[model samples]
Every structure is written in structure tokens, then in C-alpha cells.
Target: MATMPSIRRASSRTTRGSAVALALTATALSVTVFLGGRTRGPAVSLSIKSPATSTISNGARCQSRGFRARAPGVSVNLWSGFGPSLGRRGLSMTVAPKAQVVELVSRVVPAVVPEDDVAIKAFSSTPSEWKGDMIIIPVYATPKPEGAEEGPNAELTGPAKELDGVLGGIISEMIGDASFKGSKGEKVSTFVPGGSAKRVALVGAGEKDKENSDTVEALGASIAGVALDAKVASVLVVSTGSQPDSQALSSGVLGKLYADDRFRTGDNVSKPVKLKSMEIEGATSDALDAAVKHARGVTSGVRLAKDLVGAPPNYLTPSSMAGVAEKISKDLGLSLTILEQEECEKLGMGSYLGVAQGAIEPPKFIHLTYKPKGEVKSKIALIGKGLTFDSGGYNLKAGAGSMIELMKFDMGGSAAVLGAAQAIGKLKPDNVQVDFIVAACENMLSDRAMRPGDILTASNGKTIEVLNTDAEGRLTLADALIYAEKLNPDKIVDLATLTGACIISLGNEYAGMWSDNDDLAAELLESSKDGGEKLWRMPLVESYKEELKSKIADLKNVGGRAGGSITAALFLKEFVTKTPWAHIDMAGPVWDAKAGGSTGYGVRTLVEFVAKQQ
Candidate 1:
């Protein structure tokens, strides 16, 4: 384990409107302090002494060691990234008249794993055999013999036996007392007295046969959360009782360590977590290496999607998003075509344009293509709804029915597809062609916004009656689906945060999936299982189509409240009659309120499905 360099910090307490004296030495200089807590004055005074020498050593203590202000219980932390220098002849103090003291922090490089690389390794070894800062061992519930006593049973097998022997039968003792039944989510941890390892954790997987990729992934995530609190830099995970999915396990381990603190500032005291590496025991094979590589690729895409979704609307407009796509295409050597508003008008995308008419920002119709170096096996199209900000248009969102502030994440579908493009472009699997499409725009309120009864024509010349302007994502997707179908792909899949009904049905844990083809649906389901994303199949009930009937146009933009999600899927199905089609309603699982980050839900599933098809 590599040790991080330590920085010394110190704090002081003073009475209201008083000066705190700071003594200077040959190498040390006075540091700037901000009084936020435990101070009662609107002004603060500081006294500094000039340093005798101009140059200082690398580890010179210019600032006080991390300490609390004794006077008013305030904390003091100085910027440690700055080199030792006063650069002045006289000591001076810049005072500000404010209610609280302000602390100036120097810019320092954060200690975290690079977004593109995750350190993970797999081995076929026991936990006790591998040395690390800590070892995470998973144990599943196994039934004991009917006549067996309250002691070691025949079911004690695999790594469990080896770990029990290594711990001097502590694991068996716990099992004998019925203290560790191996129920899912149950955990027990202990410190090693004298061994290569410092600590050991036993996590439970409910049943041996019931374990899958999701179970392993969840277990690995739990381990990461606990280990981060423990501040363990390196970890070794030992899987017992059954084979765990190596990719899912590793992805979970790294995923939980992901923290987006790009905007963090001020005199915060919590230390940042920096996990160096993770090694998995009992996961040894050539396929396992490939799985780990694939896992890294998918994780990169998911991270990109989450970043895009979390970005503020002002920073991620349609034009700005196109600029990002342009850079990604250039970097990955993929073909990129960006259509401006006029170009889309020439293409007669009325339904898409109608939604854009309300916003001041110009719409961007982005198309990206990826081709393999070898012979092509199949062509696939992925379309995403890119309403960067959805304000529900003319039938404006308000009160409880409104979440206008968080509408910046309306482009979640596009973020997922773009993320997949980033991964696939780098992975470059042979014998497959993919087309990525997004009708990126905003749905804001304006005089030009489409009215509730307005009729708009799609690129396919299908007229839609706008029953609810809030249902604008489907309109944009309508034209994108038509454009994708023209590419003559073997299959087409479109994803959107289109309806609340889907969220009501599936909640935030799983995304709702609907498909016209059973084989395609089955293939995607299997791929999602491998990717560790939960997806539930939904029905495209034939009766739901009748609810979308428009007296004036070919169809209504939205159906009534009852079975609204099914009707929404039915409406999208009209645009792609020639191709095998599937619709993924990603309204739920995109934003994680509990986890406090964009879930990046569909990127891994898409990448896995496409990779297998290739």
C-alpha cells in the first residue's frame, strides 16, 4: 500500500473582534484562516510574522497542524498543495467585514482513481492465502444435515472450510451458535490478531443456488461502502460456496468508490476516500480477464452518462451536447453528423421541430455511426430522447405535478446511448455496425410552444394530436425513430424518460422494457442479466392503442391516465413498422435520490447486448 503525504494543519480561537497572533519561523509562513463556526463577531483580525529564509523544504510546516480553535470550537485547515514561500518583504493581513471568516484553499490534485481505469485483478486462491489490508469473504446459507449436532457440518465446503481453519474455527463457532445464518445483507467483521491481513469480513448471500450476477454485484457494493468507512486502501475479495460473476463483482467494487466532487469547495473536514486496488479470489480464467475488461468499458460509459445527467441545464444545452459528441466522435474515430435546426426542417421533422419551437436554443439532430474492421454481421440502431430541459411545454408543469427544476436530466436516454457509443467505439468488436441517434432539444414554455390541441406531422408524415404537451419526449423520438428506420437496421431500440406511469409500475429499482419481437426481447433480457441491470418486460396490450385515437389526427401524443405507459409504447411502435423494435421506458432508475447520483441505468445493458450480438 502506498502512503499518502501528510499535511499539518492547526486552528486558533479568539474573542469577538480580536487579533490572533501567528508566530513565523525560518521556514514557516502564516496561513489564511476562515472562522465559520464558534465565533460571534462580524470581523476577524490576523497578525503574521515574516519568514527569515526565502526558500523552504518540501515538508516544511508553514501552517499549523490540523486542530480546532480552542476559543470558539472552530476548525482550521490550510491549503497544503502550495509550495513553501512568502514572496513578500513584510507580513500583512487582508481583512474582510463579514459575519463569518472566509478560508482560502489552494488548488490541489485530488487523490482518486482515474475515471477511465479501475484497478482490479482476479485469482484462484483462498482469503487467508492472499495478503492484503483487508479481505472480504462472502458466505451463502447451506442447510445442515438432519441428524447433525451443533458443530461442524458436511456442508462446510470450499473457501469456507479454508477460512474456518485459518481463523481457528471462529467461522464454525459462529455457525454453530446460529449467529451467522448467511441471510442476504447480513455481515460480520473482525480484526485479525497477527496475520498478513488486518481485518476480515463475512458477507451473506441468502441461498447458494439463488446467487447470480446481481447478488455478487450487490455484495461487492456493500463491501465497498463498509471498506470506505474503514479507510482500507487495498482489498482482497474471496467468494465461497458458488461461482460469482467476476465482471459484476469488480464493477460493483469500483462503482461504489465513484464520487463526483467536481464542485466541492470551502473548509470541509471530511477526508476523501481513495481506494487503490481490488483483487478477487476464485475468479480465474481467460474469459474472466475478458469479462473484467468489458466491465471496465461498461463502467466508463456509465460514468459518462451519470456526469451528463448530473450536469446543470445551462452547461449541457443541445448545442453544447453536440459539441461534446463531436469531440467524442473525433477522439474515438467514429463518424459524426450534426444536423442544425434548418437541416431538420428540410427533412420535414415537424413533430420534432414543434417541441423545439418553444425553446430559444436551436435543436441538434445528432447521428453517429460505428463500423467494425471486419465483415459486418448485423446493423443496429439506438435512439434516445434528448429533451435537455423539459418544462412540460404549453400545458406547463406546476406544483406537485411539476419538477421543472430537475428537468435538466430529461436527456438521460441520450446520455445512456452516447455513453454506449463511447464504450463501443473504444472496444471495437468485430462484425457489427451501430447507428446512434438523438433528437436533442429543450421543451420550454414560450408563445411559439405547441398548444394542447395542436396537430403536428412527423418525418414519416404521421400526424399526432398534442393532447398533453408534457408528453414531448415521444414526439422527438417519433422523428428519430423514422430516421433510424430509414437506415435499414436489423433491429431498433429506443429509450426515453417518457412517463410517470412506468415509474409507478416498476418503481426506481428496475426499468420497464417492451418489445414487438420475443427473440430480441429475450436476447436483451439475458444481456441485461449479464450486465447487472434490472429490467422488467412490459406488455404492449393491443387494447391500449384505442386510447391513443385522435379524432383529427392519426394518433394522439398521449393517452388517458389509465395504462398510460402501455399506450405510450403503443404510440412509439407506429414509427418503426419494418424493423424489429423495442422500447425501454427509463423514467425510473435514472436519478438515484438515495445514492445521490445519476444511476447511469441502461448504458451497460446496451453495451452488453451489442457486444454479444457482434
Candidate 2:
């Protein structure tokens, strides 16, 4: 089994922070960069093949190329394509009748990491030391005098110029010929002859002033995408910017490459996740290891959440949700307590149980806790609305714009919370105690399902009139909020795919945040911004609570259509008497149809919120 590289982190991060970012000062000294045209070969496709008698230094038989198909139980990993040359077009692979070829491939590829686990050491590594497949250099476009060519001429940075000279000016020539604009997410690749690396790619990046943690992370994701296109196993990222950038780039890279192909078969399988390792050039050692560790934690957490949210409702019931939580707690060494339906009834959790009445799947009230070893500086609670499925009960969701077909993601909030739990568990950040709770269940339509106008009592002893059975998320959260408050944590935050009104208000890019506490709201905002998750604070209007006023009950589950998101927040506010609380209605961003996947949106923002706590 492969073990993590020994961390040679510098004494204190404060010392490395002064090194001024992972700035690609390529030559160790600052110099001007240029793309002046000179004689050099263009990026081209190549094919490389080896003799059958050839054997790798590790005594494993391998090839320069591989087939898309693998024998049952066969795997192709990091050492997949370390042959003499980069193969393309002509050298296609076919499935072997026997397991000999695959077995040989597996021999070269060490099973150090279980396929799902992950980083780029966000530190300096000279090109001479790397015998990797590709090197991606991110260049930003700077304004300059208009020239007689494609888009305005790019003003190369110091690192770009140094590498251009080292690579024999092929990068500059490729940029000019390809009209490479250093805009975000843009990429152009080229081949190198007698260069520092085998193949090279110059990707577009945002300007110096526009660079931040989020943008840097986006840039990293772009670099990973380009590398995947190149189909290379290892890469060296020539990082940009002049700030302390660690976790952002690594998370963005691995997160972008994340896939849930568990059920895929034959050609339906996603990419092999072939890109194994990445190294950051010219970075501080401490920052690099720190970045790798945090990025793996957060992104893996995100992948876990994505897998859950992407799963079909039937495959991820309340029982299975609790099962998954159990596995996470056991694996991460966190304390766990699962309350069954009967147990919940004894505690008066009528509001939460009401939604589960119609489903064959029993309700699971899950609590996973992470306690610091010594002094606990603070405590916080994270709750996810774990509605495995929502059929809208008597208020069957049906209309011109019904999302009932995609209701599986109604539990995105729960996915986010648990995802953050996995990350926090792995990181084990000191001095903060975190409680993760999920009231897992399904809201289905049946004779036993709660009907509209039925009154349900929450754990807090407050009555709620279920005027719209579709507003079931708030009902589940009402009980959770009350349950979270009982713990007496420093604060509480709950996420739910609770309202369509939020999607209409904020679109799919941002989560609607509602909190009465100014400090809590601001703190969360900063975290989201840093993590590259969009969040907008909606007013917790006191007057909107009138819309939820019920004649027969203390409150109605929903309010009038106008400012519906605001009223949803107000409805949840009733459960909390003290302990700063915030509600995130992440409806639109939960499931991204365009990307054809779940966003796993709240993990980073939530992790930042907890980790930043003193």
C-alpha cells in the first residue's frame, strides 16, 4: 500500500506566508516575460509503442496506451501510461480476452490510494527534478498596445518568459498561432522537443488584481481539465498570483475531476480518473502539504455529498442514509447516535415524523459528533434536511414547472452537512466541537401521508399547520432546529433544498442565506466568498412572519408566493430561541442540470465556517 509522503513542512505557517503566495518566480529572480516569435516546432500529436519484451524498472509489463475497456475486476491507475512516448490516434487499445495484460498493468500501478481518495503539493519543484508527462503554465492577459495579430498581445509574466526560453519558445509561438486569450478557463496545448517537460500547455488565467482564493481555485480546476484532455498521468502546475493560495487550487482541481460512476458499465464508464499527481512550482513546503491535505479532505467530502445527492431516491432511503452516516462516523472516528422512529416519537418529534408517515422507509434521526481532544474553544451544529424522497404527500407536486421528477435532491442540505462532517473528521481541526444532525426520511404520497391542513407539533412544542404538504423540508428542519438548540452549541446552521422561491430569487449560482445575527451572517458570507460558493443574505423580515400566521395553529409551513424565500427563513426562525442560527436555502445550486450532476455546494462554505472558529 502507498503511504503519504513524509511532510517536511516549515516550522510555522507565518514564516511561509511571508514568501508571498505560490508565485511562479520560475528563475528564483524576477524578470520580464515575452512571446516574441522565433523558430520552434508546433504542438503535435504523437504515437509511442514498446516491444513485448520490454519491462519497466519496477519489473512490471506496461504499455504507452490502454483500452477503454478493462476485464472484470481489472484496474488502470497512476502508473497507467509511463511508456517511452505519448501515444495517440493510431495506437488504440482493445479489451484482452485474458487478465494477463490487465494484471501486468495493475502491477505497475500501486494501489496506494483506494480509487476514490486524492492533490498538488502546492510548493516549489524545479522542472529539472520532474520526469512527468505534462506541465501547465497559467498566463494572465495584460492590456498592452494593440498589435497586428489575433486578440491583443499577451504580456507574459516572469515565469512564462523563463519557461519559454527553456522550452525553446514553442509556448510563445503556440499562443500567437492559437490566439490564446488569457481569459478564465481557456487552454491551449503544445509539444516540446528537448524541453524541461514532455508536453506543455499554457492556460488562460484572470489578471493579477482579479486573483483571489476563488479565482485561483477556478484556475486550478481549469488546469486539471486541460491535463485530463491531454490524458496525462502526472503534471506540474506553474501557479500564478501573489497571495497565500493553498487549498483553493487543489480542491478546485480534484473537485472538477470528481465523478460518481459507481453504476456505470461497459463504455458508460466515466474517465478512468487517470491524472494521478500534480505538483506546484515555486511554493512554500508547508503551504504545499497543507494545501494537499485540506484539498483532499474538502473535495473528498464534496464527492461524498455529490454521490449521495446524485443517487436515486429508492437507492438512498432514510435507513441507507443512516447507514452511510454510520460508516462515515466509524471511518473517521467520530461519535454517532442514531434515533429510530419509535425513539423519535418518545421525544415528541411529530413535525419530523409527519413527513415519513407515507414512506415504507423508516425515519432515521442521525447525529454525528466531532469533539476536540483537549480544550473545546467553541461548538457548532450542522443540520441537513435528509428527505430521501419527497412525493409532496397530499400536495402532490404537479404543474407546468414541476420538479417532482428531480425531487431526490431535496436532501441536498443533508448531503452538504454530512459532506462537511467527513471533511472535518479527516482534518480534525483543533479547539472546535461540531455536531452533525440529519432527520432522514422520505415524503411520499399514500393514504397514510399527512394531508394539507393537518396540524403537526414540532419537538419544540410549537404547532405547524401543513397548508402545503410540498413545504415538507421546513417541517423536517423545524424539529431539527429545536433538536440542535437543545445541545447548547455556540451557533447552529441548517441547509435545505427547502424552497423553489429561493431558486427563482437567486438562480442556480447562489444559496439564499437568512440569519438575524449580523456577526454570523457576515462570517458565513466571508467563508462562502473564500470558498468560491456564491451566497446572498436575504432579509429575515419580522413582518413576513404574519404571512405564516395560522388561525387554527401557531404557524403555517409556508407563506404567500411573494418573498416566499424570506418567509421560509422566518418559519424556521421560530424553532430557535437563542444561539446564533443561520438557514441556507440551497434549492437551485443543489442539482446542476447543465453540468449533469450535483454541485455539492455547501461543503466548502460550511467547512470554512467551522474551521475558522476560534
Candidate 3:
């Protein structure tokens, strides 16, 4: 484990307003005073009132207005001037105030600070300071060039140091660290004392920079993570500028926050945390409200997925997975059907049943449908390989392969599909119907367990040669994909932790994607980028199909070592006739030994894609 640097506490002060203002001008200043459990100090209130212009002047009096501070000598200063179209710019006293915070902060701090320093600062801040908080940030924005609003690269800068410090502190605390490791140009947190706020966050906005929506989203997420955990009911984001739209900033931040790790579980086993409201300062009230709503919805979807993925295998087994769908249908007014082992047998799912035969628990084939509230325009089907566990079957794994103990994540595909359904159910888009199909079972070892070289028939009556029992994910998906095609879907997307070859091909950073349709691939790629899930498309070579051809069986369960991932996808492609389809191999992302936990990878990307299509 890495040790984070401690947040150095500055000394306390009770100077008249003027002395505190003068103190702020100095390079290193600290003001620490214990206010009545609720009230912050007078000088600190003045500083936050109008951080840009309100110099820490002498004898500043603190007056309270609902949790906000008002005082003499407090005035607002616009940095570069406000505008709708300012390109990227760094934060400097000389630059226009319109710059984005990310650019400005990036220039001042080392490149590494975005991830490391932010994490450190966030973790170092005390949780008490973060409790029930509202941190205000003042920023400047620049005007855009005439008639160039739609031109490429019209993005702007964000808030300044005050904002970064607050965000960093919140993030560090959430991840149980004082510092953060994040993407580039992101500001970390800094500390401020004395205000109604338990903690005041100050972020810097670079001069003359345009805004990047993604950066704002990240900001919102960081804030929410801290606020919710701190048991804070609300957060007030104060922006300084005539044209500063609080709604836009809030929307961006909240949206991103809601999306990231929305589908996660805390080890503490505590009750769920909820955020009540977010108030925006210095920006339009409409934008603030819109931001709040968007954040709520996005986070709601993410949390649903996280809850499903985080559940242990015992609680989320095949029958339990079916039960989950049944409950969702009853609660959300959706349609659901659960097929038992007898039904699957009637459908001739021999290849799928072969894997289930090993386990004492019966397998379940779940079909969950979401009907449109209005006219249906597009119908899509999602198939997930719900292998509860993989024990390597007859060709039992040994030594390093024994690490397959975490194979419970083999059902990660099912988690993603179920998670997507939950999100769509809440959003309730019109004219788009979606069906979720999961072939849920366990691949265990027993007297009746499947053996290598065994031949099994699929639901489509196609015989499969099971050369390796370890390759059971594809076997289950084969029947599920065929079942999805029966619905005549406009598009079919299947997710599975099917192959280790995928881990080798794309590493842990990216999921391996195989698709025959270019349009589907493009749409999925765009969704992945928006959702912050990395995916790399791999070719489905025509030659790879040869590896699955068997002398007796219609296809072989395991392909050759070379292009093993691609061949596995090729095997699945044979099940779908004309429906545009894509396969996501999530072997690398399902579980993380290095991180000592599960990643919950495909849920976000799948949900985003489905929501966008609707």
C-alpha cells in the first residue's frame, strides 16, 4: 500500500477583517479557529463572498444569510470577462477570466499533479470538515471569436485553485487516501478554513479558456462522491462571472459523478447514501436545477448496476438472477419470463446444459423484456453469459490456473445485461423495446461434469464439439444468442467473460470487441468513450472460422491458441443469422486480482449505449 502525505494544518487566527485580507496576500497563510459548531469566522466569510475581488481587507464584519456569508469590503471581480465562446487558455493573472479551470491548473501544476496531487489532497482532508458541506468556487470565462461558435476546438477552461482544492479533498477522502490519481489537466483539492461550510473548496480557472463538458462532469462526480459519503444533504457550487452558467457547470459535474462507479458496493455493508440537493452560486438557477436532475438520474442508473455487480455469487446465482429479473419486472412494470432446466432441455440446449450438468444447482434461462410506453421503433436484444463459476471442467486447472477461484465473475456478462435493464426501466424511453436474455448456470466439477471431446447439441439443433470444458462461456452464449435471434431483433449485443485471450489481446485497460456490423461498432465505440470504458475492436477474420469446424459436431467449443479470442467470437457469430451483432469479451475486466476487487466494467458502457439508442 502507498502512503499519502499528511494535510498540514495552518495556524488559527482571529484578526479583524483587514488583517485577514492582508494575510491572504502573503504566500503562506493559515487561519484556524473553531467556530460555533455551525458558524465560520468573519474573515473567511469575506474571502468566500467574492474570492476574486474581495481582498482580505481590515475589519471585515461577518453577517449571515441562510448559511451564506455577507460582509463589508466583499466585492466580486470578473477575471477575463464572460462569454459563450472562449477557446482553451491557461490560468494566469494576465489571461482573460474566461479560461477553463482545467487548462489553467494544468499549466501551474506538474502533469502528474492531476492524478497524484488531487488524490493526495482529497484523502488528506478530514471527514469532519467534509460533513454537511457546500464549497464555493469562483471562475472567469473569455468571449469566443465572432462566428466561430460551431468551429472545432471551441471548448473553455474551468474553475481555479479554490475549486481544485475542494474537489481533491473530497475525492481523496472517498477513495480513503489523501491524494488522487486521475486523468490529465484535472485539478486536485486545496483546503480553506472558517465559513458556515465545514470545508470550503477553492478551484482555479485558467484565463480565456472555453469549457469542456467532460471535465465538468468529472468535477460533479468528485463532489457527489464526497458529499454523499460525508452525509451532506446538499452542496452549493458558487461561480463568479456575469455569464457564468451555474446550471451548465453543475450539470457537467453531476452527470459525470453519477455515471462513474454508480454500480459499486461499499465493503462496510452500510445503508445506501443519498444526496438531497445541490445549489449553484453565480450561475443561472435554471442551469443549476437541470444539472441537479441530470446528475440524479445518471447516478441512479449507475448505483443500480453497481448493486447488481457487487452482490456475491451465492446471492446472485442462476435462480437468484432470474428472481432479480422477476422482481424488476414486478416493480418497474416490465415483462419477464424465466425458463427452468426442463424448458431449456425442451429447447435442445445441450451445449449450454452440458456446463450446468456439473453443478448440483439447476440452471435458468431468463428473458426479461422492456416494452415501450408508446409506439415501438426499434427492438434490440441483449444476451449475457451467466456462468456462475468456472471450475475448468474435466481438464481441471492447476498451479497458477488455480487462481480461477474468482471465476464467480464469469457471470459479469449477466450483471451488465441486468444492470442495463434497470437503467432503461428508470429512464423509460419511448419507441424503443429492449429484451435481456441471460443463460445462467454454474460450471462445476462432479461425476456428471462435462468432459473434453464430448459432443453436445445446441438449442438450434447444431451439434458442438466440446474440446475443452474451460471454454464454457461460449457454449452457454451459443444457445442464448440463437434465442435472441428468434426475437428478430434490430440489433443484438452479447457480453461475456469468455476468454483469457482477450486479456492478452487488450490487457486490463481495454475490453476486446468483435463485431460484424460497422454501424453497431461505431455506436458502441462512441458510447464507450462517453462512459469512460475502454474498448478495442478486433477483426473477425474469415479464416478463424476454420478452427471451430469439427469432423462430427457442427462447431468446436475451443479454438486454436492463435486468435483464440477472435475464434471464440466467430463461433458465436454462427448462431446469429442476419441480426447485426457485437460481442464483448470482458475476461480482463470482470475481476481484478491486482486491485483486489471487481471492476464492474461493461455495465456502464452497455447502459449508455442502450440509453442513447432509445
Candidate 4:
């Protein structure tokens, strides 16, 4: 929970028809009446007798006036005011119990803390100008030789040189002793005895030649990990070597500061130490401004994705998920269209409905659009698989294959696209129009659940044979991909946690990419690289389509055990024929086994790719 600034309370009770005169200021606005004339301890009535038509924007004065009322049972509504329509509105209200008034006001102000309360700032100032609880300096894994001079080593070239001089060569001595080689994920900390800063932390950046946005972001997150429970009010990150990508570095810090402690209970519960501010040093004024804009969009998308994926299945059902989408559209001013299950059936989404039939929850097909102010430069469609929970249907995941408890995360792709929509909607590019699509549903075990050997047709008239019910993600995506193609966008990209075979091929650190067009594949690769995401291009393998061919239907949902990921991609390719399309299989990197929580993969990639369309 975030600590609220001091609030001023004004209280007073007046008998019915008896008026109390009060002076109103800029911070405190007029009052609104609730449950009018309801009586309890003291029947306090309020009327706006003053002609204070001017509105106040300051929050402090509002708190001050809230507590200054004379009536004991009177309560001031913090977020109330009068406007032109109801001109000459005043602050006169009646209340019930005296004790209930104060308690209600207290509860209303700081009840639920939204996830984006923390602020991240990037500054053009030097290390010496930053004073905080802790300052982090990133150093290369290799250090200068014992007898090496100052100009020869790149690590000592920038603000780091001045920092070392201030600390009496402590950084150099620590690196010289071979104790802190600055290897990735390595850290060392010490107290700054003379400076304004209380502590200084050194983080590893690996080899200089191999440095990229990923390495820089990893180093930033590593620093945040140490500061998590240190009760540090503010953090400062200083660049020692070549300046890393400012946006990636700052985003990593912001993503870590976000905590999902909403449901935590018990006396020993750990509360995240709220950070007052985060500052990164050593950038020009213009550069700092650009970095701040990009980081704001990317971090917001990442946090939203993490929040959705972290939600339990029961709490985030298909209906509730549509509710969230509706709220986002309302808040961000995006055009939203939600199709009910009956409407989807009209479009002949047999493949999608087949997987959804087992669950009691109704399916929702979500379509959200973002348009620029000027003439559009390009059109792009982003589709995400929205299986809120996957029980492997009738195949029934058992033993080692069953990770049913963690099935809530199967909607990672949906979270990413929605997160990107939340970002692009706010960061509105001037040239591109984007459509975000998701077919949200669940695959649960029941009498109506989809079974093996089921034949289903997609919206595009292509049939799929469901050989293995566990391969249901692709079934849901088939109709979504077909729907996206009908929009006739220049390019389409779909993200999904489709197959474990990709994890086997590329480990948990990388996502597999399959594309039919070379240019589209290369562009997405470069965008992911700049966004600090790892995407490895895999072959479309023309021959792999042979494995998906079925005896009766157009294709099979699963292609045996060999090259399973490629075959799944091939199945989706059947639906998208014209528009250049790329498929991202992110089964592995979406969730991390590390102690704290999810890594929030693919959000940055989607945001970056869409932003570039500008």
C-alpha cells in the first residue's frame, strides 16, 4: 500500500433547517448530499449558502475543508463539485452517525492502491547531483589492468571516472582485486561515508562488446531486486560504461517496483517498500525526454500484462475479462466491440467454439481499435490467444503433464496484446491504425468438453481434426487468425503459448518466430531486439505441412511429437493466406521459476512493433 499525504478533516453538525456558514478555499470544493435527511445521533443538515461559483483544483485545500465542518456527523465528499449546468452549487449536506462519517472518509481515500502508483524519472544530471538512499553503478565484467592508465579503459571514460575520484579509487580497487568482475547478475554494495548518498551498489554488465538492451535491462532489474526490501525511499542509477538504452534500463526498474499483493493476508505479510522516485543519470536533456516517453508506454503495457496473468482463473473469467476490456476502452478512449457467444456462432467459428463448449462460462470475442488523428500510414492487426484456463479438455492432463494449477497463465498472449492496446491507445501514434483481437474462453473438463477426434471448421472454411485435445490453444487461435485476415491489414502477427516443443528447442530465455515473408520476419526481429526481447527465427519448413494433413479434414490440430512447434505454426498458416503474417510461440518465457513472479514477456515486443508503424 502507498502512504497518503496528510489529509485535513473538518467536521460539524447542525440541526435541521439551521445553517452553518463556512469559508471555502481553492483546495476544497462544494459538497454533495448522500442519503438525504437520514437521521441518527444528530440530524445534521447541509446547504450551500455561499455563492462560491469558482472551482478549486488543488487537493490539499479539499482535505482541509473536509475536516473543518462544524457538525459532528457531517462528512465532506472529497471528489464533489458544481459546474455551469448546476451553477451556484454550495457545500451543505446532512449525515447520520458521527463515528461512521470519519471512518468512511478515511476508508474512501486510500482503500485500494492502483499498480501504477510508483513514478520513474530519467534525468540529465550527473552522479554527484543525485542524492538518494542508494545509487547503482553498472560496471563491465572485465576491468582495467593493474597498471593500465585512465584513457585506455572504456569503463573509466565517463562519469564513472569522477565517481572513482570521489571514492578514493574504491571502484577500481574492488575491480582490481578480481572480487567483482561485473559479470551479469553479480552485485556488490558499500556505504558512502562522505557523500550525501548513504549507500552505493555496483552491478555487473557482462562484456562490453556483447552489451545490448537485454543485458542493460537485466542489470537494472538486478539492482531493483536488491533494493526491494532495503526500505530505500529513492533509487539512482548511474551509467559507468557506454550509455545503455535509457528506455530499457528505466523500464526494467519500473516493472520490478510493481507488486501484486492484493490478496495477501496474515499478520506476517510483507509490504513492498514504496519507492518515492527512481532516477537514471548521464543523458542529454533531449535524450532524457525521449527515453521517458518510450519507457512510460512500455512499462505501462508490461505491468498491465503482469497484473492480468497473475489473476486467478475464478477471479478473471471470460465475462470478467470482457469487463476489464470495457473499462480500459472507456478510460483510454479506444473503440471497442465485444461479440457474445451467439454472435460468434453466426460467423461459423466452429474451431473456437469447440474448445469453449466444455466450459460453463460464455465466450467473448474482443475487438479493440486505435486510430491516429491524421491519415493512416499503415494498418496492422495483432491477435492473441485468450484461453483463460486450459484443462487440456477431454484429454485430461494427468501426472507430470498436468500443470492445471498454473493454467490461468495460458492467457499470457491475450494479456500482452491488451497491454499493448492500453499503451498504444495512450501513446497514439500519428500515422497507424491498429486492431487488437482476442477470442477469450476456457477449456475445462466436463461432459460438454471438447473430445479427441473432433472435426471443427474455422471461420475461413478450413476444417481441423482435433487429434489431441491438449493442443487446444491452436484451435482457439485458428478462428482468430482467420478473422484478422478478413480485415485485410498490411501485416498480421499472433502471439500464443502454443507448444512446449518451442521451449525444448529454444529454452526458456527465447521465443520461436515463424513467418512467411522475409521482410516482415526481419522487421519484427529488429523491433523485438530494440525492445529487449529475444525472438529467434525458425523455419516455416514447407515440408512440415505434410505432417498436419488429415485423412478427412483439412488439417490436424497436433502433428505427432516431431517438430511439434513448427507443425502448429503450419496449422495456423492455413487460415492466413494473403497478408504477410508472423507467429510467435512463447510457451516458455512467459512465466519465470524465480522466487518473485512472472517476467511479463512479449509486451515490449508488441508495443515496439506497433509504435514503429507510425
- Best of the candidates, TM-score: 2
Q: Per-model C-alpha lDDT, please?
A: 0.73, 0.74, 0.61, 0.73
Q: Candidate 3 on 1-614: residue-level lDDT in tens?
A: 43322213232323223222222332212122112111222333324312345444332333321112223322221112112232321111111111222222222211221111111011123323434465534333234347864222212123323344544544234222422222223233434455446655433333325444454554555555555555555566544333333333443444433222322468643344445555554444455455444434444444444444555555555655666676668768889887766578678888888898776556879999989878888898988889877778887766785656677778888878886777677667777899999998988876557788889899888999899998899899999999999998899999998888899888877888999999999989988876667888999999878888999888888779999999999999989899999999988777655644555577667766876776
What digit string (tens of lDDT, one per residue) describes model 4 on residues 122-161?
A: 6666677677888778877654568865222224547777
Residue ranges of candidate 2 with Cα displaced over 4 Å: 1-119, 122-125, 144-151, 239-244
C-alpha lDDT of candidate 2 relative to the true structure: 0.74
Minimum summed lDDT over a 10-residue window in model 3 is located at: 113-122
How do all the candidates rank in terms of TM-score, highest first?
2, 4, 1, 3
Q: lDDT tens digits, residues 1-614, model 2?
A: 42322212121121111211111111111111111111121222212112322221111222321111111222211112212232311111111111222222222222233224334665354555567789888888664436735447455556556667776778789888977778787788877777657898888776666778878788878988888888888888764344336677777787778656655788997767778778777777786788778888898788778888888775676766776787788789999998876578779999998898666455889999999888999999999999988888888988878888898999999999999999999999999999999999999885447888899999978999999998999999988998999999999999999888988989989899999899999999999987778999999989888999999999999899899999999999999998899999999889888887788889999999998895
Question: In lDDT terms, how accurate is model 4?
Answer: 0.73
Those runs of model 1 whose alpha carbons end farther than 4 Å from true positions after fitting are 1-118, 124-129, 143-160, 163-178, 267-271, 542-546
Per-candidate total of colliding backbone pairs: 5, 4, 82, 21
The runs of at least 3 residues in candidate 3 whose Cα sits more than 4 Å from the true structure, single-residue gaps closed, are: 1-132, 136-198, 203-214, 225-233, 240-276, 282-298, 592-596
